[model samples]
Target: MEQQTQDKSTMVVFSGDLDKAMASFIIATGAAAMGKQVTMFFTFWGLNILRKEEYVNVKKTFMDKMFAKMMPQGPEKLGISKMNYGGLGAKMMKYTMKKKNIVTLKELIEMAQDLDVKMVACTMSMDVMGITKEELIDGLDYAGVASYLADADESKINLFI
Candidate 1:
């Protein structure tokens, strides 16, 4: 872990779509299992994936409240990028994945956490969206682009999803 070298994998998650978030977690867990140092930086809409599934009692401005109300709480509420059809597509996709025994996004997130894959939430994005750290899940690092860049610079692989 001390060595910042080629065995590192980094991804900037800028999409909140269920498919994109799942893909990011899948890659992160897979890379971690392969013994790579993985870091997933979530920004903008992607931050929604880290939000608490239950409503958090955090004080916010009117605009912030609006954003919170509109944004998805967690992986379960995320919509697919295409064919969402008012979230029906996401529901269908989750059902099919479960039927096929494919690991769901929530499971992938747990795997990533268990594997020690770093999950970073962009503080700047959170501020803009009126999201508080308390509103997100636990065991996450709050940072800015500089921190993400540092990880990316040391990583052999970097992706923006």
Candidate 2:
């Protein structure tokens, strides 16, 4: 019998918004659970979602420290894309999700990791933003646009968020 290849799903996460990040993770995890090969390429502000909440105390340049202090620390600190109301909107959204019994974004990300979904952090974006590997969550690959394009080219499903 001939073996069938699994479908591939590639997602380019470019948004830092809490809601959008949650959506991306939800889709990635769902596809992975369905036995599809999934890759999530995080770029630009999307990288913020993978940042560590606690300070890592890594030696960085003055500018890098400034950038780190200015940006959201992690997924829990991300604001909504619209009507953020100084972060109130994000809190409200989390509360609503909890009330509705929806899986939290953190949980979705954890599930994706557990399912062996590939997580790639865009090197170009990191360089431009002065974000170091130590600031991001562990167990993720670092690559550039060409790498993401390679995966996207083979993917039947692709999304940019």
Best candidate according to TM-score: 1
What are the per-residue Cα lDDT tens digits for candidate 2 across 1-161? 01222488899999999999988998999899999889999999999999988888887789988988888989899999999999999999999999999998888888999999999999999998899898899999999999999888888889999
Where does candidate 2 have its weakest 10-residue lDDT segment?
1-10
> Clashing residue pairs in candidate 1, if any?
none
Q: Model 1, range 1-161, lDDT digits (tens) per residue?
A: 43667699999999999999998998899899999989999999999999989988988999999999998899999999999999999999999999999999998998999999999999999989999989999999989999999999889889999
Superposed Cα deviation of residue 48, candidate 2 (Å): 0.6
Model 2, which residues run further than 4 Å from truth?
A: 1-6
lDDT of 2 at 42: 96
Best by lDDT: 1
